[model samples]
Target: EYGRDNGIRLSAVWLTHDPEYPENLPAAPLVRYGWTPRGELAVVYDRSGKQVRSFTYDDKYRGRMVAHRHTGRPEIRYRYDSDGRVTEQLNPAGLSYTYQYEKDRITIT
Candidate 1:
């Protein structure tokens, strides 16, 4: 199913556990999508409506993904350059990868 707000689309989608499951249980009990007002994916829930994962976006960067947190895990973050290219990614383990761009090649360090 979907909800539209002015021009946004695809608010939610139901998935099946098994295509050949019985008619009464063709689809999974519950799986939901939560969308931001700007049409960005915000969170996902399981059958009990518990958040499975959540996402955060950078409003200043044309909706570029800035961070994402999963249940029981530390949030991962990203940084972008002025050109909107990803410059750094920091993971839960505190390891960070930095990206450098050249005229024809990209390097990670």
Candidate 2:
């Protein structure tokens, strides 16, 4: 399989077969990737075409991931300060954590 972004190989899995039955072996995609218009990875799917994860980017900040969701896992979210530094994080357990940044140090709580 190839990615739509740059024609790059995304995922490829081929079954092995006997030498005489090479034609019986077929290549299959183990994973698939979906890209945003700016070429950012937006979503992922398993070989069965089940959604694995999806990413959400911040509209005001390019390339900034504001949240992501994974199958069977809790969704994680992030909040960025004006400087584009992560200021707050919400974990899968619904706990909120805050971060502070200084010129040369970082403080998390």
Top-scoring candidate (TM-score): 1
Q: Which ten residues in a row have the lowest lDDT in candidate 2?
A: 5-14
lDDT per residue, candidate 2, 49-91, as tens digits? 8889999998877799999989888889999988899999898
Clashing pairs in 1: none
- Model 1 scores what on Cα lDDT? 0.79
**What C-alpha root-mean-square deviation, in Å, does candidate 2 show against the real structure?**
4.4
Most lDDT-accurate candidate: 1
lDDT (10s digit) by residue, model 1, range 23-46: 555244366778887778899888
TM-score of each: 0.75, 0.70
- C-alpha root-mean-square deviation, each candidate: 3.0, 4.4
Candidate 2 structure, TM-score to reference:
0.70
**Candidate 1, 85: how far from true, in Å?**
0.6
In candidate 2, which residue ranges exceed 4 Å CA deviation? 1-4, 7-26
